[model samples]
Target: MSAEQDSVFVRNFALVIATLVGVTVLLIVIANSVFGDMDPERQALAEERAEQNLSPDFAVRLSGEPAPAIASADSGADEGGVTEVRSGEQVTQAVCIACHQGNFLNAPGIGDKAAWNERIGKGWETLTQNVADGYGNMPAQGGAASEEEIRAAIEWMVESETGLEVPES
Candidate 1:
Protein backbone atom coordinates (compact mmCIF):
# COMPACT_ATOMS: atom_id res chain seq x y z
CA MET A 1 0.00 0.00 0.00
CA SER A 2 1.05 3.63 -0.48
CA ALA A 3 2.28 5.68 2.51
CA GLU A 4 -0.84 7.90 2.32
CA GLN A 5 -3.16 4.84 2.33
CA ASP A 6 -1.16 3.31 5.25
CA SER A 7 -1.45 6.59 7.20
CA VAL A 8 -5.21 6.77 6.52
CA PHE A 9 -5.62 3.14 7.63
CA VAL A 10 -3.61 3.78 10.82
CA ARG A 11 -5.68 6.93 11.53
CA ASN A 12 -8.96 4.98 11.07
CA PHE A 13 -7.69 2.16 13.32
CA ALA A 14 -6.68 4.65 16.00
CA LEU A 15 -10.08 6.33 15.82
CA VAL A 16 -11.84 2.98 16.20
CA ILE A 17 -9.72 2.06 19.26
CA ALA A 18 -10.29 5.51 20.77
CA THR A 19 -14.05 5.24 20.24
CA LEU A 20 -14.12 1.83 21.97
CA VAL A 21 -12.11 3.16 24.92
CA GLY A 22 -14.39 6.21 25.21
CA VAL A 23 -17.51 4.02 25.04
CA THR A 24 -16.10 1.75 27.76
CA VAL A 25 -15.32 4.71 29.97
CA LEU A 26 -18.77 6.18 29.36
CA LEU A 27 -20.44 2.90 30.27
CA ILE A 28 -18.40 2.62 33.49
CA VAL A 29 -19.34 6.18 34.43
CA ILE A 30 -23.02 5.56 33.69
CA ALA A 31 -22.99 2.36 35.76
CA ASN A 32 -21.33 4.05 38.71
CA SER A 33 -23.78 6.99 38.57
CA VAL A 34 -26.78 4.61 38.40
CA PHE A 35 -25.65 2.11 41.08
CA GLY A 36 -23.17 3.99 43.28
CA ASP A 37 -25.89 5.37 45.58
CA MET A 38 -27.42 2.05 46.64
CA ASP A 39 -30.12 2.32 49.33
CA PRO A 40 -29.17 1.13 52.82
CA GLU A 41 -31.58 -1.86 52.66
CA ARG A 42 -30.34 -2.99 49.25
CA GLN A 43 -26.71 -2.53 50.28
CA ALA A 44 -27.30 -4.52 53.44
CA LEU A 45 -29.00 -7.29 51.47
CA ALA A 46 -26.15 -7.37 48.99
CA GLU A 47 -23.62 -7.56 51.80
CA GLU A 48 -25.56 -10.40 53.45
CA ARG A 49 -25.73 -12.32 50.16
CA ALA A 50 -22.02 -11.78 49.62
CA GLU A 51 -21.29 -13.15 53.09
CA GLN A 52 -23.52 -16.18 52.51
CA ASN A 53 -21.97 -16.92 49.11
CA LEU A 54 -18.39 -16.54 50.41
CA SER A 55 -18.93 -18.65 53.56
CA PRO A 56 -17.20 -22.05 53.48
CA ASP A 57 -19.51 -25.09 53.32
CA PHE A 58 -17.14 -27.33 55.21
CA ALA A 59 -14.06 -27.24 57.46
CA VAL A 60 -10.82 -29.23 57.27
CA ARG A 61 -9.39 -30.89 60.37
CA LEU A 62 -5.97 -32.53 60.64
CA SER A 63 -5.52 -36.06 61.95
CA GLY A 64 -5.51 -36.47 65.80
CA GLU A 65 -7.34 -33.14 66.16
CA PRO A 66 -10.50 -33.21 68.27
CA ALA A 67 -13.56 -33.33 66.02
CA PRO A 68 -15.73 -30.26 65.97
CA ALA A 69 -18.99 -30.48 67.92
CA ILE A 70 -21.85 -31.26 65.58
CA ALA A 71 -25.04 -29.29 65.97
CA SER A 72 -27.94 -31.71 66.37
CA ALA A 73 -31.61 -30.91 66.07
CA ASP A 74 -32.31 -33.04 69.10
CA SER A 75 -29.60 -32.22 71.64
CA GLY A 76 -31.35 -33.67 74.67
CA ALA A 77 -29.75 -36.71 76.27
CA ASP A 78 -31.30 -39.13 78.78
CA GLU A 79 -30.39 -39.39 82.49
CA GLY A 80 -27.63 -41.92 81.64
CA GLY A 81 -25.93 -39.47 79.25
CA VAL A 82 -27.20 -41.57 76.33
CA THR A 83 -28.98 -39.62 73.66
CA GLU A 84 -32.43 -40.81 72.74
CA VAL A 85 -32.17 -43.83 70.47
CA ARG A 86 -34.03 -43.41 67.22
CA SER A 87 -36.65 -45.97 66.32
CA GLY A 88 -36.19 -48.65 63.66
CA GLU A 89 -38.30 -46.85 61.08
CA GLN A 90 -36.59 -43.55 61.77
CA VAL A 91 -33.09 -44.97 61.46
CA THR A 92 -34.00 -47.01 58.39
CA GLN A 93 -35.61 -44.02 56.69
CA ALA A 94 -32.86 -41.59 57.61
CA VAL A 95 -29.76 -43.71 56.94
CA CYS A 96 -30.47 -47.10 55.41
CA ILE A 97 -33.03 -45.80 52.89
CA ALA A 98 -30.32 -44.02 50.92
CA CYS A 99 -28.80 -47.32 49.77
CA HIS A 100 -31.38 -49.96 50.65
CA GLN A 101 -34.35 -48.27 48.98
CA GLY A 102 -32.93 -48.70 45.47
CA ASN A 103 -30.66 -51.65 46.10
CA PHE A 104 -27.77 -49.35 45.35
CA LEU A 105 -24.32 -50.92 45.07
CA ASN A 106 -26.02 -54.35 45.07
CA ALA A 107 -27.62 -53.60 48.42
CA PRO A 108 -30.84 -55.47 48.97
CA GLY A 109 -33.87 -53.44 48.08
CA ILE A 110 -36.22 -52.62 50.95
CA GLY A 111 -39.12 -55.11 51.22
CA ASP A 112 -37.46 -57.49 48.79
CA LYS A 113 -38.29 -60.76 50.52
CA ALA A 114 -36.04 -62.78 48.27
CA ALA A 115 -33.02 -60.60 49.06
CA TRP A 116 -33.75 -60.39 52.77
CA ASN A 117 -34.29 -64.15 52.94
CA GLU A 118 -30.66 -64.76 52.04
CA ARG A 119 -29.30 -62.22 54.51
CA ILE A 120 -31.80 -63.25 57.16
CA GLY A 121 -30.17 -66.66 57.12
CA LYS A 122 -26.98 -64.92 58.26
CA GLY A 123 -28.86 -64.28 61.58
CA TRP A 124 -29.54 -61.07 63.50
CA GLU A 125 -26.16 -60.78 65.23
CA THR A 126 -24.18 -61.40 62.04
CA LEU A 127 -26.33 -59.06 59.96
CA THR A 128 -26.15 -56.29 62.56
CA GLN A 129 -22.39 -56.71 62.85
CA ASN A 130 -22.01 -56.63 59.07
CA VAL A 131 -24.03 -53.45 58.88
CA ALA A 132 -22.11 -51.83 61.76
CA ASP A 133 -18.76 -52.79 60.17
CA GLY A 134 -19.99 -52.22 56.61
CA TYR A 135 -20.35 -55.07 54.15
CA GLY A 136 -19.80 -55.05 50.38
CA ASN A 137 -20.18 -51.56 48.87
CA MET A 138 -21.70 -50.15 52.07
CA PRO A 139 -19.56 -47.91 54.27
CA ALA A 140 -19.20 -48.51 57.98
CA GLN A 141 -22.45 -47.28 59.47
CA GLY A 142 -20.98 -47.46 62.96
CA GLY A 143 -20.05 -43.83 62.72
CA ALA A 144 -23.51 -42.81 61.51
CA ALA A 145 -25.62 -44.86 63.95
CA SER A 146 -25.06 -46.55 67.29
CA GLU A 147 -25.29 -50.35 67.68
CA GLU A 148 -28.85 -50.06 69.03
CA GLU A 149 -29.83 -47.87 66.13
CA ILE A 150 -28.19 -50.28 63.73
CA ARG A 151 -30.19 -53.18 65.13
CA ALA A 152 -33.37 -51.15 64.87
CA ALA A 153 -32.60 -50.23 61.25
CA ILE A 154 -31.93 -53.87 60.37
CA GLU A 155 -35.13 -54.99 62.05
CA TRP A 156 -37.07 -52.34 60.16
CA MET A 157 -35.37 -52.88 56.80
CA VAL A 158 -35.21 -56.66 56.97
CA GLU A 159 -37.92 -58.03 59.28
CA SER A 160 -40.63 -55.40 59.01
CA GLU A 161 -40.20 -54.72 55.34
CA THR A 162 -39.50 -58.23 54.13
CA GLY A 163 -41.64 -60.15 56.66
CA LEU A 164 -38.63 -62.36 57.22
CA GLU A 165 -37.35 -62.48 60.77
CA VAL A 166 -33.63 -62.26 61.20
CA PRO A 167 -32.63 -65.41 63.14
CA GLU A 168 -31.37 -64.35 66.53
CA SER A 169 -27.85 -65.78 66.92
Candidate 2:
Protein backbone atom coordinates (compact mmCIF):
# COMPACT_ATOMS: atom_id res chain seq x y z
CA MET A 1 0.00 0.00 0.00
CA SER A 2 1.00 3.64 -0.52
CA ALA A 3 2.15 5.84 2.43
CA GLU A 4 -1.15 7.79 2.19
CA GLN A 5 -3.19 4.65 2.26
CA ASP A 6 -1.16 3.30 5.26
CA SER A 7 -1.70 6.60 7.13
CA VAL A 8 -5.44 6.51 6.40
CA PHE A 9 -5.60 2.89 7.59
CA VAL A 10 -3.73 3.75 10.78
CA ARG A 11 -6.03 6.75 11.42
CA ASN A 12 -9.11 4.58 10.92
CA PHE A 13 -7.72 1.93 13.27
CA ALA A 14 -7.04 4.58 15.93
CA LEU A 15 -10.58 5.99 15.54
CA VAL A 16 -12.06 2.50 15.89
CA ILE A 17 -10.04 1.80 19.03
CA ALA A 18 -10.93 5.23 20.47
CA THR A 19 -14.62 4.65 19.78
CA LEU A 20 -14.47 1.26 21.49
CA VAL A 21 -12.75 2.78 24.53
CA GLY A 22 -15.32 5.57 24.63
CA VAL A 23 -18.17 3.11 24.44
CA THR A 24 -16.64 1.02 27.23
CA VAL A 25 -16.23 4.08 29.46
CA LEU A 26 -19.79 5.19 28.69
CA LEU A 27 -21.16 1.76 29.58
CA ILE A 28 -19.20 1.72 32.82
CA VAL A 29 -20.54 5.17 33.79
CA ILE A 30 -24.10 4.15 32.93
CA ALA A 31 -23.73 0.94 34.94
CA ASN A 32 -22.36 2.86 37.93
CA SER A 33 -25.25 5.33 37.77
CA VAL A 34 -27.80 2.53 37.55
CA PHE A 35 -26.36 0.26 40.24
CA GLY A 36 -24.09 2.41 42.41
CA ASP A 37 -26.67 2.70 45.20
CA MET A 38 -27.27 -0.90 46.23
CA ASP A 39 -30.02 -1.77 48.71
CA PRO A 40 -28.66 -1.90 52.28
CA GLU A 41 -30.18 -5.29 52.99
CA ARG A 42 -28.94 -6.71 49.69
CA GLN A 43 -25.49 -5.31 50.30
CA ALA A 44 -25.42 -6.87 53.76
CA LEU A 45 -26.49 -10.23 52.33
CA ALA A 46 -23.87 -10.03 49.59
CA GLU A 47 -21.15 -9.27 52.13
CA GLU A 48 -22.30 -12.14 54.34
CA ARG A 49 -22.34 -14.52 51.37
CA ALA A 50 -18.85 -13.42 50.37
CA GLU A 51 -17.58 -14.01 53.90
CA GLN A 52 -19.14 -17.47 53.97
CA ASN A 53 -17.69 -18.34 50.57
CA LEU A 54 -14.23 -17.24 51.68
CA SER A 55 -14.35 -19.20 54.95
CA PRO A 56 -12.38 -22.48 55.07
CA ASP A 57 -14.46 -25.66 54.89
CA PHE A 58 -12.07 -27.63 57.13
CA ALA A 59 -9.31 -26.99 59.65
CA VAL A 60 -6.04 -28.83 60.26
CA ARG A 61 -5.13 -30.10 63.75
CA LEU A 62 -1.65 -31.29 64.72
CA SER A 63 -1.18 -34.74 66.23
CA GLY A 64 -1.15 -34.87 70.09
CA GLU A 65 -3.29 -31.72 70.09
CA PRO A 66 -6.76 -32.00 71.55
CA ALA A 67 -9.48 -32.56 68.95
CA PRO A 68 -11.80 -29.69 68.23
CA ALA A 69 -15.21 -29.88 69.89
CA ILE A 70 -17.99 -31.03 67.57
CA ALA A 71 -20.83 -28.60 67.12
CA SER A 72 -24.39 -29.92 67.57
CA ALA A 73 -27.59 -28.13 66.72
CA ASP A 74 -29.46 -29.54 69.69
CA SER A 75 -26.72 -29.62 72.32
CA GLY A 76 -29.25 -30.98 74.88
CA ALA A 77 -27.04 -30.23 77.86
CA ASP A 78 -28.55 -30.43 81.37
CA GLU A 79 -27.80 -28.10 84.31
CA GLY A 80 -24.68 -30.18 84.96
CA GLY A 81 -23.37 -29.24 81.46
CA VAL A 82 -23.23 -32.95 80.54
CA THR A 83 -24.39 -33.04 76.93
CA GLU A 84 -27.02 -35.67 76.19
CA VAL A 85 -25.82 -38.35 73.82
CA ARG A 86 -27.56 -38.40 70.44
CA SER A 87 -29.45 -41.59 69.52
CA GLY A 88 -28.12 -44.14 67.05
CA GLU A 89 -30.64 -43.10 64.45
CA GLN A 90 -29.73 -39.45 64.87
CA VAL A 91 -25.98 -40.10 64.65
CA THR A 92 -26.46 -42.37 61.66
CA GLN A 93 -28.53 -39.76 59.89
CA ALA A 94 -26.14 -36.92 60.68
CA VAL A 95 -22.77 -38.59 60.03
CA CYS A 96 -23.04 -42.03 58.44
CA ILE A 97 -25.86 -41.28 56.01
CA ALA A 98 -23.62 -39.13 53.80
CA CYS A 99 -21.63 -42.20 52.71
CA HIS A 100 -23.88 -45.12 53.71
CA GLN A 101 -27.03 -43.86 52.00
CA GLY A 102 -25.43 -43.82 48.55
CA ASN A 103 -22.87 -46.56 49.22
CA PHE A 104 -20.26 -43.99 48.35
CA LEU A 105 -16.66 -45.18 47.92
CA ASN A 106 -17.85 -48.82 48.00
CA ALA A 107 -19.33 -48.24 51.45
CA PRO A 108 -22.15 -50.64 52.39
CA GLY A 109 -25.51 -49.08 51.70
CA ILE A 110 -28.03 -48.70 54.48
CA GLY A 111 -30.25 -51.80 54.79
CA ASP A 112 -28.13 -53.82 52.36
CA LYS A 113 -28.24 -57.18 54.11
CA ALA A 114 -25.56 -58.82 51.99
CA ALA A 115 -23.09 -55.99 52.50
CA TRP A 116 -23.84 -55.77 56.22
CA ASN A 117 -23.50 -59.53 56.56
CA GLU A 118 -19.93 -59.39 55.27
CA ARG A 119 -18.99 -56.62 57.74
CA ILE A 120 -21.23 -57.92 60.57
CA GLY A 121 -19.12 -61.06 60.59
CA LYS A 122 -16.27 -58.81 61.63
CA GLY A 123 -18.23 -58.29 64.89
CA TRP A 124 -19.13 -55.10 66.77
CA GLU A 125 -15.77 -54.45 68.39
CA THR A 126 -13.85 -54.88 65.16
CA LEU A 127 -16.37 -52.84 63.17
CA THR A 128 -16.44 -50.07 65.76
CA GLN A 129 -12.63 -49.96 65.87
CA ASN A 130 -12.45 -49.87 62.08
CA VAL A 131 -14.92 -46.99 62.02
CA ALA A 132 -13.07 -45.16 64.81
CA ASP A 133 -9.84 -45.28 62.80
CA GLY A 134 -10.65 -44.45 59.16
CA TYR A 135 -11.65 -47.67 57.37
CA GLY A 136 -11.33 -48.00 53.59
CA ASN A 137 -12.71 -44.80 52.03
CA MET A 138 -14.50 -43.87 55.27
CA PRO A 139 -12.95 -41.26 57.58
CA ALA A 140 -12.60 -41.83 61.31
CA GLN A 141 -15.82 -41.25 63.26
CA GLY A 142 -13.99 -40.78 66.58
CA GLY A 143 -13.74 -37.04 66.06
CA ALA A 144 -17.42 -36.79 65.13
CA ALA A 145 -18.86 -39.03 67.87
CA SER A 146 -18.02 -40.75 71.15
CA GLU A 147 -17.24 -44.51 71.20
CA GLU A 148 -20.78 -45.20 72.48
CA GLU A 149 -22.26 -43.10 69.69
CA ILE A 150 -20.12 -44.96 67.16
CA ARG A 151 -21.37 -48.30 68.50
CA ALA A 152 -24.96 -47.07 68.37
CA ALA A 153 -24.52 -45.80 64.81
CA ILE A 154 -23.06 -49.14 63.76
CA GLU A 155 -25.99 -50.96 65.39
CA TRP A 156 -28.47 -48.69 63.64
CA MET A 157 -26.85 -48.83 60.21
CA VAL A 158 -25.93 -52.53 60.28
CA GLU A 159 -28.31 -54.33 62.69
CA SER A 160 -31.42 -52.18 62.83
CA GLU A 161 -31.39 -51.28 59.16
CA THR A 162 -30.17 -54.60 57.77
CA GLY A 163 -31.88 -56.92 60.32
CA LEU A 164 -28.48 -58.55 60.89
CA GLU A 165 -27.09 -58.25 64.38
CA VAL A 166 -23.43 -57.42 64.68
CA PRO A 167 -21.60 -60.06 66.75
CA GLU A 168 -20.35 -58.57 69.99
CA SER A 169 -16.73 -59.66 70.36
Candidate 3:
Protein backbone atom coordinates (compact mmCIF):
# COMPACT_ATOMS: atom_id res chain seq x y z
CA MET A 1 0.00 0.00 0.00
CA SER A 2 1.12 3.63 -0.51
CA ALA A 3 2.64 5.44 2.55
CA GLU A 4 -0.44 7.69 2.99
CA GLN A 5 -2.82 4.70 2.71
CA ASP A 6 -0.68 2.68 5.17
CA SER A 7 -0.77 5.58 7.65
CA VAL A 8 -4.53 5.83 7.27
CA PHE A 9 -4.92 2.10 7.79
CA VAL A 10 -2.75 2.20 10.96
CA ARG A 11 -4.75 5.18 12.32
CA ASN A 12 -8.05 3.35 11.66
CA PHE A 13 -6.75 0.20 13.36
CA ALA A 14 -5.58 2.27 16.37
CA LEU A 15 -8.99 3.93 16.59
CA VAL A 16 -10.74 0.55 16.46
CA ILE A 17 -8.54 -0.80 19.27
CA ALA A 18 -9.10 2.31 21.40
CA THR A 19 -12.84 2.16 20.83
CA LEU A 20 -12.95 -1.51 21.77
CA VAL A 21 -11.03 -0.80 25.00
CA GLY A 22 -13.30 2.14 25.86
CA VAL A 23 -16.43 0.03 25.21
CA THR A 24 -15.07 -2.79 27.43
CA VAL A 25 -14.37 -0.33 30.27
CA LEU A 26 -17.83 1.22 29.94
CA LEU A 27 -19.46 -2.21 30.00
CA ILE A 28 -17.54 -3.08 33.21
CA VAL A 29 -18.72 0.11 34.88
CA ILE A 30 -22.33 -0.52 33.83
CA ALA A 31 -22.16 -4.10 35.05
CA ASN A 32 -20.88 -2.97 38.46
CA SER A 33 -23.61 -0.35 38.80
CA VAL A 34 -26.35 -2.74 37.61
CA PHE A 35 -25.29 -6.04 39.22
CA GLY A 36 -23.87 -4.53 42.44
CA ASP A 37 -21.30 -6.27 44.66
CA MET A 38 -22.91 -9.67 44.93
CA ASP A 39 -24.34 -11.89 42.20
CA PRO A 40 -26.65 -14.71 43.33
CA GLU A 41 -24.62 -17.39 41.54
CA ARG A 42 -21.34 -15.98 42.86
CA GLN A 43 -22.76 -15.71 46.39
CA ALA A 44 -23.95 -19.31 46.26
CA LEU A 45 -20.60 -20.46 44.98
CA ALA A 46 -18.81 -18.52 47.72
CA GLU A 47 -21.03 -20.03 50.38
CA GLU A 48 -20.44 -23.50 49.01
CA ARG A 49 -16.73 -22.92 48.92
CA ALA A 50 -16.78 -21.58 52.50
CA GLU A 51 -18.68 -24.64 53.68
CA GLN A 52 -16.33 -27.00 51.87
CA ASN A 53 -13.30 -25.29 53.37
CA LEU A 54 -14.52 -25.91 56.91
CA SER A 55 -13.19 -28.99 58.70
CA PRO A 56 -15.38 -31.82 59.96
CA ASP A 57 -15.10 -30.38 63.50
CA PHE A 58 -15.91 -26.85 62.37
CA ALA A 59 -18.86 -26.42 64.72
CA VAL A 60 -16.87 -27.51 67.74
CA ARG A 61 -13.81 -25.50 66.73
CA LEU A 62 -15.80 -22.31 66.21
CA SER A 63 -16.87 -22.17 69.85
CA GLY A 64 -13.54 -23.31 71.26
CA GLU A 65 -13.18 -19.96 73.00
CA PRO A 66 -15.81 -19.26 75.60
CA ALA A 67 -18.13 -16.50 74.40
CA PRO A 68 -17.89 -13.17 76.20
CA ALA A 69 -20.39 -12.85 79.05
CA ILE A 70 -23.67 -11.25 78.07
CA ALA A 71 -25.79 -9.77 80.87
CA SER A 72 -28.50 -11.89 82.43
CA ALA A 73 -32.15 -11.64 81.36
CA ASP A 74 -32.96 -9.36 84.27
CA SER A 75 -31.06 -6.15 85.27
CA GLY A 76 -33.49 -4.06 83.22
CA ALA A 77 -32.45 -5.47 79.87
CA ASP A 78 -34.91 -4.19 77.22
CA GLU A 79 -36.14 -6.23 74.29
CA GLY A 80 -33.57 -6.53 71.49
CA GLY A 81 -31.05 -4.93 73.86
CA VAL A 82 -28.21 -6.28 75.95
CA THR A 83 -28.73 -7.49 79.53
CA GLU A 84 -25.61 -6.00 81.07
CA VAL A 85 -26.23 -2.87 83.14
CA ARG A 86 -23.31 -0.71 82.09
CA SER A 87 -22.47 2.49 83.94
CA GLY A 88 -22.52 5.74 81.98
CA GLU A 89 -18.74 5.78 81.94
CA GLN A 90 -18.56 2.15 80.93
CA VAL A 91 -21.08 2.65 78.16
CA THR A 92 -19.24 5.74 77.01
CA GLN A 93 -16.00 3.80 76.86
CA ALA A 94 -17.55 0.76 75.21
CA VAL A 95 -19.69 2.29 72.46
CA CYS A 96 -20.32 6.02 72.75
CA ILE A 97 -16.65 6.89 72.39
CA ALA A 98 -16.59 5.31 68.95
CA CYS A 99 -18.77 8.07 67.49
CA HIS A 100 -18.98 10.74 70.16
CA GLN A 101 -15.35 11.33 71.11
CA GLY A 102 -14.45 12.70 67.70
CA ASN A 103 -17.94 13.28 66.33
CA PHE A 104 -17.78 10.56 63.72
CA LEU A 105 -21.12 10.07 61.91
CA ASN A 106 -21.96 13.68 62.86
CA ALA A 107 -22.18 12.68 66.50
CA PRO A 108 -21.80 15.50 69.00
CA GLY A 109 -18.40 15.19 70.59
CA ILE A 110 -18.31 14.59 74.32
CA GLY A 111 -18.78 18.02 75.94
CA ASP A 112 -19.54 19.84 72.71
CA LYS A 113 -21.46 22.78 74.19
CA ALA A 114 -23.04 23.96 70.94
CA ALA A 115 -24.07 20.49 69.81
CA TRP A 116 -25.42 19.48 73.23
CA ASN A 117 -27.32 22.75 73.57
CA GLU A 118 -29.22 22.17 70.36
CA ARG A 119 -30.50 18.79 71.56
CA ILE A 120 -30.78 19.88 75.19
CA GLY A 121 -33.30 22.52 74.17
CA LYS A 122 -35.47 19.68 72.88
CA GLY A 123 -35.91 18.46 76.51
CA TRP A 124 -34.57 15.37 78.28
CA GLU A 125 -37.49 13.10 77.45
CA THR A 126 -37.22 13.90 73.81
CA LEU A 127 -33.47 13.38 73.86
CA THR A 128 -33.66 10.08 75.74
CA GLN A 129 -36.52 8.89 73.55
CA ASN A 130 -34.51 9.76 70.50
CA VAL A 131 -31.64 7.74 71.95
CA ALA A 132 -33.98 4.79 72.44
CA ASP A 133 -35.37 5.13 68.93
CA GLY A 134 -31.98 5.63 67.26
CA TYR A 135 -31.72 9.18 66.00
CA GLY A 136 -29.84 9.84 62.78
CA ASN A 137 -26.73 7.63 62.60
CA MET A 138 -27.01 6.51 66.20
CA PRO A 139 -28.45 2.99 66.45
CA ALA A 140 -31.22 2.47 69.01
CA GLN A 141 -29.93 3.27 72.49
CA GLY A 142 -26.51 3.62 70.86
CA GLY A 143 -26.52 -0.19 71.19
CA ALA A 144 -26.59 0.09 74.99
CA ALA A 145 -27.98 -2.60 77.32
CA SER A 146 -31.34 -0.90 77.80
CA GLU A 147 -33.24 2.36 77.75
CA GLU A 148 -31.93 3.13 81.24
CA GLU A 149 -28.36 2.58 80.18
CA ILE A 150 -28.93 4.66 77.09
CA ARG A 151 -30.42 7.45 79.19
CA ALA A 152 -27.56 7.28 81.63
CA ALA A 153 -25.04 7.50 78.83
CA ILE A 154 -26.81 10.50 77.33
CA GLU A 155 -27.11 12.14 80.75
CA TRP A 156 -23.45 11.55 81.40
CA MET A 157 -22.55 13.06 78.05
CA VAL A 158 -24.85 16.04 78.52
CA GLU A 159 -23.91 16.67 82.12
CA SER A 160 -20.22 16.44 81.44
CA GLU A 161 -20.48 18.69 78.44
CA THR A 162 -23.08 21.23 79.53
CA GLY A 163 -23.30 20.70 83.31
CA LEU A 164 -27.06 20.29 82.92
CA GLU A 165 -29.00 17.56 84.70
CA VAL A 166 -30.98 15.07 82.65
CA PRO A 167 -33.43 13.31 84.94
CA GLU A 168 -33.50 9.51 85.09
CA SER A 169 -36.62 7.58 84.09
Q: Per-model C-alpha lDDT, please?
A: 0.84, 0.85, 0.77
For every candidate in turn, the CA RMSD to the true structure comes to 7.9, 10.0, 16.6
Instruction: Tell me the tens digit of each residue's lDDT in model 2 across 21-110.
Output: 999999999999999999999999999988887765344545655544455566555343346787899999999999999989999998
- Cα lDDT tens digits for candidate 3, 40-136: 8999998998997784634454746644344675745554546457787787888788899998999998988888877776777788788787888
* Candidate 1, lDDT over the whole model: 0.84
- Which prediction has more favorable TM-score, 2 or 3? 2
lDDT of each residue in 1-169, candidate 1, tens digit only: 8999999999999999999999999999999999989999999999998887776534454565555445566656423334578999999888999988987998999889998887788887888898899888989999989999999988888788878888789
Deviating ranges (above 4 Å) for candidate 2: 1-79
Top TM-score hit? 2
